[model samples]
Target chain A: MAVEVVYRSSRDLERLFMDKAEADRHDKMLELAEALASALQNAAPTLSEKQADDLGIFMARHRELFARAFKNNPEALAELPALEKN
Target chain B: MAVEVVYRSSRDLERLFMDKAEADRHDKMLELAEALASALQNAAPTLSEKQADDLGIFMARHRELFARAFKNNPEALAELPALEKN
Candidate 1:
């Protein structure tokens, strides 16, 4: 079998990445997600922990758009795909 | 202002991408997330609509690792970062 080198994010050891940069990026993303979740919980105490986490990760994943949306460009949110309605 | 060209995903007109390929990819990801949310709701009728959408998008974002974990490598999930516990 061919040997392969992979890097694992310290924050998420279950994932293996072919590139160190990618691994670092993944770790940073998770860090941001955690922070966002905490902030969401603090801002809306009524929100369930899972709901906060779900929104946190979702926002973290699309952080660029969110950042823009918050920066005098609320219209940026309209650029986001509409979530499926019940 | 300098002129700029961008691509808008048909399914998500609010967002613009510098690259057509990236816009297409984003669109496809959202499509997958929507389908996943529907399936989740169908399987777990008690889940709130937002919960299902949140989970669907989360899974779609990490589809690679999830696919590996589902394919007899459950340990792969362990590599995922632990979300904050309330």
Candidate 2:
């Protein structure tokens, strides 16, 4: 009989972003989207195809908020992470 | 009126991501979310507060898809971009 040990590591998306602030912004955006979707679902359990389209429009409009937020937080965009030169 | 030249620069979120591949992934994720939301809205033009909640929940659920997609693209996570050693 052979025993195998499995190891699992934490899934941190921070690795994808340039810095902690950027990652934090992404996390907040996801949370906001989730909250909005949940609120919509609770208000109307049933949605027609047309209603779905409206919801999407709302989301698209709100997406601009991310850029606006970034504009207000110039520090987040102050400098690009220096890339390694090979 | 005093003539003032105003300059506008491109708002590139790619600067936030670690690399081009990571930025591409983020862009795809946003596009998919917008599409889904748009489809949902078109299907149902009107949504109550509860319906909004449902949409938020849906967005939250799909958020995990980003991680799953990343897992399939291990190259995106191969190694962190080396930080500048000051």
Candidate 3:
């Protein structure tokens, strides 16, 4: 077998990246997601950990639109860009 | 005073906007800020209300950078654009 090198995101060892930058990015995203989840749980104790984690990941994935909403263009929230199917 | 028609953001009665769109945007930003403040307070009870509000506004204003960080580019947090002086 040929030797292959791949960078694994520390956040999720299951996934591997061809480039270090990509792995770093993924790790960063996971960190932000955790922060968001923690915040959500803190503010609303009624929410389960799973709910908070799911919401956190969702927000992190669509954060650009969220940024626009926070940036004084709430209408941007309604305008979601088309996503590519894997 | 000249007869000037201005729009006011319901979020903050003290501020007035020259355009309706601008007012709407400001209102939206305030709404987001409030949500963020609530989250901050919820997740971290040690933070005072004032501190939460201040941080919320700061995050809301610089949401683009925050979004980038959430989108797997945490380095974006270090790349802040210069703000215009009023």
Best lDDT goes to which candidate?
3
Which has the better lDDT: candidate 1, or candidate 2? 1
Please give the range of 10 consecutive residues that has the lowest summed lDDT in model 2 chain A. Answer: A77-86
The order of the candidates by TM-score, greatest first, is 3, 1, 2
lDDT for each residue of candidate 1 in A1-86, tens digit (9 for 90 to 100): 99999999777879999999988877766766676556435433555787666665655555565454333333444555555232
lDDT of 2 by residue, B35-63 (tens): 43443434344545555444433442344
> Order the candidates by lDDT, highest first — what do you get?
3, 1, 2
| Model 2: per-residue Cα lDDT over A1-86, one tens digit each | 87654322123343465466666555544444443344343434476544433443344234443222222321221232222111
In order, the Cα lDDT scores of the candidates are 0.60, 0.39, 0.65
Query: C-alpha displacement of A24 in model 1, angstroms?
Result: 1.9
- What's the CA error at residue A86 for candidate 2, in Å? 60
In terms of lDDT, which candidate is stronger, 1 or 3?
3
For TM-score, the strongest prediction is: 3
* lDDT comparing candidate 1 with the true structure: 0.60
Best by the DockQ measure: 3
Distance from true location, Cα of A42 in model 2, Å: 7.0
Comparing 1 and 3 on DockQ, the stronger one:
3
Compute DockQ for each candidate against the true complex: 0.03, 0.08, 0.14
Q: Which ten residues in a row have the lowest lDDT in candidate 1 chain A?
A: A68-77
